[model samples]
Target chain A: MYNILEFTRNRSTSVEQTDDKTLRSYCHLNDTIMEAYVEIAVTIPDLEIISVQGDVLRPHKKEFKESFEFLKRVIGTRIGPGILKIVNGLTEGIRHKQFAFMLEECCHAVILLFTKEDLLSSPRPDDEEESIIYHRQMVLDNIRLYNRCAAFAPGSRIVEGIIPKDKDI
Target chain B: MLKFMRNKIVGIEVKDSNTVLAHGFLDDNIYSIEMNVLIDINHLEIRDIDGRWNRWTTTECKRAIPFLKEAIGLRMEGDFSQTVRKVIGRRACRHFANLLLECCYTAKQASEVLKDKFKEKHDVNNVTSENNSDKNVTPIISADMPDHSDTPFHDKPVSFSMVIDLHMHSFPASPCSSVSVDQLIKEAKRIGLDAICLTDHNYVWDRDTVEDLRQKHGFLILRGNEITTDQGDMLVFGMEKDIKGIISLAELRKEVLESRGIIIAAHPFRGFLTVGIQQIGLTLERAIKRPMFKYVDAIETLNGSVTENENRFTEKVAERLGLPKTGGSDAHEVSRVGVYATGFIDKIKDEKDLVDAIKEGRCLPTVFRKHAGLR
Candidate 1:
């Protein structure tokens, strides 16, 4: 239903080993005659969302600002299962679904960056290592579930953190 | 992505209804920074100046102005941000640096728009003339252009884009500080600070060391000291004589006032923390009403490392007294170098300009949100 007119993603790491790595995403969307650009940056190793700067590029794009600003609710969100929850809640009140999809696209790019960092790889001995691994795996699995259900009916409830009623016992 | 055919001019204007900021490229290389601010009762109009690299206010600008002139002349054949950073580095005019980069990006958008307009009108020769000339004159909005409701959120003109934290503690000087001077400098750069003052508790930075750091980093590092008074802590700048052993508030005031120095009540609202039933520093209610308050230049309205209630109380006290307000991080830790700052309308070159700005009420207290550095 929507076409991506342009898209770019950039990944950069600091010179130090313990420093944060950042991923920046920019996308241009075209639905009919309307067009807009979305820019987002996220830092990993601590999962701090920097900024989401986007604006529609046409005179007819007057009514899209509220939806675009909703994207800013993504700031300070960590890249985990909670990130998707926050993004969904922020975009729920938007009049346009295109902005929501664009936000998801940007968020997903950040999650992929976490995966590229091998967040779910083996862990060495530490006080909280196992707990940290469990949390990361949960986030990865939650993202998988989200991708699986993305094609479902828009308003259908995909209950999170719960077992389905009709599932096999 | 829009590809640049040649050196293009870009404009960035961030404005609210009453306060308007209009600045960008005046020529292909020169930048014009201007602001018309309306904060509370203050109405200040910042004027423009000429000369490419002669008259700069901050130390960073002083060091980088010549380099910028040379660098802008070089053709950009590769990544622009990296090239620019390599030339000027991060410590030089950080806030203005961000503004310049945004202007370059906006120029690309403008170029694309002009290309479309040219295609529609079937006039190729007129495109460059129309776009380039308009930019040369003023990259920002014209007098006749109507107020558009669709300005980009990030592009909105901010009231005081430049902020300098005037109260800070470094590890070597202040025993209470947890962050080293080098770490503090790094964080200040990351937070895009225009300038910073190293004001350790009861300790003055060595003049030679301060000059050495400023030279090495190319950032404005002002010399100041946080004096622990019997009444409270005071941030004093521009003191020509020694103030090391002055304990009485009245005596300190006399010396400071005589030497044309300025003092600000530092975190008076943040009463001394209690440890084993022993409390220190003057309370907010008592500090503002003290006779010493009358002698000080300004009240520190926002202290970054303090609680919200403390800052609120400080703001109320300042407002009630009709005193000019200032802000600082009071940063003992490196992570909070620029969470709060004092915003000055005019560029500050030295301690005297800083003192003058406060005395003339040309400065405003400002607080940035938690993690404002990311934005």
Candidate 2:
């Protein structure tokens, strides 16, 4: 078991050093009752998405697995200001808002990993482009806050980031 | 087969437009088909009555002839074949379909004559005229759009005075682009660009908004789309609709050919990364060759985001294939605007003019190290 974890860690390191134009990142959101994960492969210098794989694991594990194919449609997406809307569009006919939310969280985490840390809070003026990036970061930051909350209470309500303290789950 | 061989069709030798070709048996006087066609391409009209069938009188086949008049308002250029198909291809009168096609061929010849006269009088070979008729099709004298022959024409003047970036992305539409339209405009103006084209991934900016911005900023804005094809990416101009990531190279080629649109291969040598399998050699050796290379108008030899080696490889392939070359900044962020551009000898007024110039092979790729802040 320990060797398997170490091999996976070394494999990810090898992928990170593969190419200057391509970057692969993975994010996992987990709790007691349900767990969600997403892996995003994107091009650098320009964030053209190559592929995405994601899934939700809940009490209805079979149904959640069926909805996993939603993210596959976002293969050739170019991630920019409208990332959330594209994510929402991926889950359009599935009528799965929970899937959309989790997929959005995964997308934010991948973008945050790719973006330079200084650019996140560069003190730029509140223009439309700058605000859109900031909003993406805020959602990522809120997910971190929620993960910390879920650590203590595994089944705590997931708060909607824009409206403070409003439980969306 | 014997009956078809016995049927005799005699085309009368007449110099007039209302000439008729009659079909009859060798000895019988009864004529099965009498086709009278008058074609005037300059006026863009075709007059033929619909042919309908009646078992009692054996006259239903004549009703399908009027459907040929649907070709009245169509131009006899890129859409000539499509217009012919829509008129008499499948559900229409199968018997008279060949007759309608023959009429169209005659109409096309007339249009060619008019086009040559206009070209000689105005020397409007490379530039689009103010008249709306020239907006869709270039002159037949300069009928240089897509031939799949891979013939290279190096006749353009070496020195050009105008510079324009042919590809860039805008926020909200290209979800991965970090630059907004306002930011791109400001950056292009600061870099002394004569014009800039917005080519967001799979999306086009509204014409009205681009026109308003062009007037306000006093800089030219050409509309284009960076279509994501299965082979790679392409920069397409003169496509009225957005077919970004959904179209294949073959389908895109047919659509672009019919629409007379210009297509340039975007960053043809940019290699993608595969897990655990590294491309150890130069990009030129490992680059996935696009099968539709012959159909593209030109190769984007200088993309700002790609490495210098990759750009050089693209140039080498383009030279070997006898294709013209173009360049673009491929800017997703604001600061990268005008990093690379295509220089044209003649000034371009709109997207149509730009497409004509590229198809004429009167433009060259240029690199701008100063504007990209690399200097």
Error of 1 at A147 (Å): 42
Provide the fnat value for model 2, as a fraction from 0 to 1: 0.00
Give model 1's share of reference contacts.
0.00
Clashing pairs in 1: B14-B156, B14-B157, B15-B157
The per-prediction CA RMSD against the true structure, in angstroms, equals 26.4, 29.2
TM-score for each of the candidates: 0.38, 0.42
The local distance difference test score of each candidate is 0.51, 0.53
Each candidate's interface RMSD (Å, one decimal) is: 24.8, 33.0
Residues B134-204, model 1: lDDT tens digits: 11111111011001111121232346645789888998788667789888887888778888899987676
DockQ each candidate and list the results.
0.02, 0.01
Q: So what's the TM-score on candidate 1?
A: 0.38
TM-score of chain B taken alone, candidate 1: 0.53
